[model samples]
Target: MGTTRTIKNKHAANGSGIKGSKASKNGPVNDGVIKAKKNAGTRAPIPGSGVKGRPNLADILKKRKKRVYSEKELGLPQLNMVTPVGVQKPRGKKKGKVFVDDRESMATILAIVQAEKDGQIESKMIKARQMEEIREARRAEADKKESERKAKLEETKDSLRKKRKRPRAGGKTQDDDVNGFEAVKALAAEGTKAAKPKKKRVSFAAD
Candidate 1:
């Protein structure tokens, strides 16, 4: 029993890394922690496995959301399948407005300011045409109003130039003058005429 105990302890029982001895707790090697490491070589790939050591990709795709694919979109290409070959992203392109480094010189800016001060900022023929049109419209409107006023003045002058009214044509003549009693009698007659309806006489002819 003493010799057997020495033989057991001779093989790195204190984790000193001796031969035929396993690593201990907190040792460099953990062979002692594994139980069935003996004859435990790397597992061979499953029969006819497309990807070694991994489950079938077709089974995974079947479990996912099903999608209909065309022959063109699902064709097998004669290129590297797993590793990417070249640039994946597309080339950069301009999106919207771009800035330019070209700037106006001081001489050009000064010339522009001077031209503006001279009231000739730039020869805008369009604006000149528009202003002419506005002037023409205003002139036409003024001419229309002036013609109407002139005709009205001419009509008034023609009316005033006519001969005076005759005294018999219901004017303020001596025949139209009346006393207070006559005026009252005329008003009473007018009131009676307005209040009564005129009767029509019906003549009967007998055979």
Candidate 2:
């Protein structure tokens, strides 16, 4: 009979089995240094700290300083202009009177103006004559109506005279008719008698 020796594993001999290096005692590594968390517990306040009681607005405005910021400080981009400055625009053409050298056209225009004037004068004269004729006709009509009225009045007067001169029926008797006739005869006889001759008075005065 032979005796055998047993070999023990090396990994089992170590304390841990992880593959990487041992972890650090502190937290994970950061690219920059970490700041410690501030204490939230109450502490004595600073004299210049916390929300300050608002100061007088007028005093603050009066004492405030004005700061002018440059374009570089404000981070504005630079601008480039391409066009030229101060170029004057073209001037417009001015208006001027033009004279014509055509004498025949000018004479024709003058003749046309004179013809218009003559037409206006003729129209005015014709209107005046027509108005005069209308007035004369009205006057003639008035005169004719007046003459007719006078003739009618004269006819009425003649009619009234005839009515007055006409004898009334049953108003005259036969005796009245006879008396009127005898009176007319006596007047005719007196008018027909001749005047007597003057008597001679010379014989009685001689004795």
Candidate 3:
């Protein structure tokens, strides 16, 4: 039992020793040491040369200055420059001159004139229609008056014909009096003749 306890204590001390130690504090593992050896062989730095600073290309371009140009050389007007050529004098009369020259401008003027003409034509047509209406109204009134006058004349003519057909007492005809006073006179004569008794009575007066 004493030998067995000594063996068990030695085994527990070995397991704890490995568990408590840090991996990075100890030397590198076999795989990591092999990778470091391969990279050092292929990527070795040059002797006496460290990392270089970036180039200052902007300072090198600033040393070369751009060329300047004069106003006369560039065909531009200068402040002190004078007019060497004299001004041209005017010529001929200004009468009968046409200001607008292009076809487009002349077409615009013609359009305005045409519009005015069309407006005038429309106005004239409207006036003509109005005048026609007035004439028609007058003709209607004249026709109405003519009809009225004709009716009055016909009425007067009909009255005159009726008066002529009727017989007047002052201008009576023989036929009209035959049935009036003439008939009465004939009856009175017949009565008087019948009343006289043969007139022989006159001879008896001698007896």
Candidate 4:
């Protein structure tokens, strides 16, 4: 009789001897493995890779239509892009008429005068106001007289212009009067004829 030998199968084990489920959650993962995953598709073509001759993940993904690429990643020259800034237009200044109220100033002046104990100052202010009023009245009267004078002068000029434009009377001589008297004498000698009726004029177009 022959001795029976046991054989181990290599395909029976799915992974490394370490079980992922049984592994400690707080344990540190391999830095090289983590780094390899992060830098899988982002590696530049300048330096040599530690691995054998193999295409990068980026190179494989670039063939796919859904992948977006940058200039640096595609090994193209970088473009200088300028961002547009919004500019506000300057507004025009309003040219408005500014009206000043003298009520406050007058009130302040009144208050100052009242605060002073001198009666002479008050009387002087009153006299100044009365003088101003009289001056204004005189100015108004002068303006009115000047306006009336201008109106009268204009009327006189208009009358002179109308006279210049008026037609002169006819210059009848003695010979013209003699001729007129002879014509009247001839008409008186002749018998009066029947007046002819005037013909009617057509006022509208025929339909």
Per-model clash counts, in order, read 0, 0, 0, 0
lDDT (Cα atoms) of all candidates against the true structure: 0.41, 0.39, 0.46, 0.40
TM-score of 1: 0.24
Cα lDDT of model 2 by residue, 1-207, tens digit: 011100011121111111111332222221011111001112312211233332342122112211112212354323434545545333474455555569988898889999999999999999999999999999999999999999999999888555333322332343246456543443345356534211111111111
On TM-score, the candidate that comes out on top is 3
Q: Candidate 3 on 32-78: residue-level lDDT in tens?
A: 33233323442422210122221232122112111112212354443
TM-score of each: 0.24, 0.33, 0.35, 0.26
The sequence of per-residue lDDT tens digits that candidate 4 reaches over residues 1-207 is 011100011111112112321352422242223223333434532222334233453243233212222212454323445535544233484555655468998788778777784677788999999999999999999999999999999999887555332311221243235456543433333324323211110110010
lDDT of 1 by residue, 166-191 (tens): 22134324323533444344445545
lDDT for 95 (candidate 1): 56
Name model 2 segments beyond 4 Å from true: 1-94, 98-102, 167-207
lDDT of 2 at 151: 100
Candidate 1: misplaced stretches above 4 Å? 1-41, 46-124, 165-207
Residue 78 of model 3: what lDDT? 35
